[model samples]
Target: MDNTGFSLASLLVVTALGLLVPLIVTRIRAVRIPIVVGEIIAGVVVGKSGFSIIQNSEWLQFLQFFGLAFLMFVSGLEIDFATLKPTKVRKGNRYARFLTMPPVFATFATGLTFVLSYSLSQVLFNLHFIKSPLLFSLILTTFDWLWFF
Candidate 1:
């Protein structure tokens, strides 16, 4: 791919279309999913898994990397660390228990899911390009503060 593929127009138009199509899908009354999931679906559809239509240039990948890092930082900031403190009155308080549930839940769920469907021919499975199912599960279960306020 030519370096010229990283132009601002290409980046903005493609990203906008990817996001916009999902937004449009969410407009249907029966479709209750969030825009973020829609964007993910759109990405998979256009990505190497579906059509191999969009080849991400290094610049685009870098931008996505930066955005993900910033989003994760923001999500971490939103966490109320005070709620996580151990309390004597309660063996495990509500907030603390709630915080613990996701990691435990994700661990079991991702492990089971991965164990059940871990095989795919290198030709059909695009996620194998990442080479680590553990990393994929972590990425999948990462908090989507993007979904909440």
Candidate 2:
């Protein structure tokens, strides 16, 4: 009821949104959208930006931190460290072998993602779709990495 205190109802609403948005998005055969993106849209619609239905509080902040930690832990568990180990090249030249390494490939892919994201962000900024190119690029880069994991 109070502005500064915790609300169990708000927490329940957030949990329901988190569960339902992904289900709804997946069930829609015509519209393609990532589950995470759908959850974010729901959050923006219900939070202060749209209807001011969920007010910020210390409990919600703590839950957010915990959720992020759990996500990172799950991602870490999904990693196959065996695939990351470099294998010996029997015949190729040094440059060819180096490029074949998993770590090198991953690094190259990540760099390419950042470069493309920055270019697209610059275009969006010029069109007034975004305010800051660099910040948007960084956010895009982070999103790409998160989605990859």
Candidate 3:
């Protein structure tokens, strides 16, 4: 692949088109696809796979981290303890619901991730290794406090 064609204008055009195409497709189909999916596809298009316009750019990595941090900060700002007043159902039920969902979801996700990791490891490495499953399970079990809002 020739790297000489890469330039600022080419990069902007590819990035813009990457963002635009998914929205256009979603609009035409009248389907609601998440912005994150669109953004990831945009990254893949501009990265190594599609146009290779901005392959392995450090700037993109920084921007990704910035986005994540900004999201987390905004999420943290939205949640307030005063907002969680439960109706007269039962004692501590409101607190339980708020606290329980995250761990439950995290646990379910971890289990699913571990199963997938184990299966992939066994298939690809041709070895009956169990370390990856436990590691992946723990990794997936973590919950972002910012996402709790």
Candidate 4:
């Protein structure tokens, strides 16, 4: 099939699954999951990894790129500006813990996690997704505390 035709079909199927699967899952309450994660599950079910309904092509990459941009835009919109400002707090308190934990502890933790994951990926098995230990480390280090509250 042509790129345009395949892209459109893929987009339609993905959009439908992305919208429907999350709604169904939330309604069923079969283990609460994030919508984005649900969408990813839907994608995997239809994509090359699952049913092989769609192939990973350059056309699909364009869609993925645009979808990522859209997701980032939505995340930016969700950010609370007030949270960006520093607040006065006592030393060695809960707030102090939150403030210090990510930068100080996460740095060492992320490095260690990267090395371990990389070694495991190399020695234990060659997994396609765990190809980039640095990227995995960055994901681990970038702690979004806002998600808790």
Which candidate's lDDT is highest? 2
Regions of candidate 1 where Cα sits further than 4 Å from its true position: 1-13, 18-22, 25-31, 86-149
**Local distance difference test scores for all models:** 0.62, 0.84, 0.59, 0.68
Error (Å) of candidate 1 at residue 34 is 3.7
Against the true structure, candidate 3 reaches a TM-score of 0.44
- Considering TM-score, which of the candidate structures 1 and 3 is the better prediction for this target? 1
Provide TM-scores for the models.
0.46, 0.73, 0.44, 0.57
lDDT of 1 at 113: 59
- For candidate 1, the C-alpha RMSD (Å) to the true structure equals 7.6
Ranked by lDDT, top first: 2, 4, 1, 3
In TM-score terms, candidate 2 sits at: 0.73
* TM-score head-to-head 3 vs 4, winner: 4
Judged by whole-model lDDT over C-alpha atoms, candidate 4 comes out at 0.68
Error of 2 at 42 (Å): 2.4
TM-score head-to-head 2 vs 3, winner: 2
Which candidate do you rate higher for TM-score, 1 or 4?
4
lDDT of 1 by residue, 101-125 (tens): 5555556766765554444322224
Q: Write the per-residue lDDT of candidate 2 for residues 21-114, one digit (tens) a residue.
A: 9889999777677786788789899998899898777788887788789878988998999999998888958898998899998898878888
Per-residue accuracy of model 4 over 1-149 as CA lDDT, tens digit each: 44444556666777678679878877855466667767887888898789977755566878789999999999999977765555555676775656554454556666776677556555433556566655564565554444334
Worst 10 residues of 3 by lDDT: 140-149
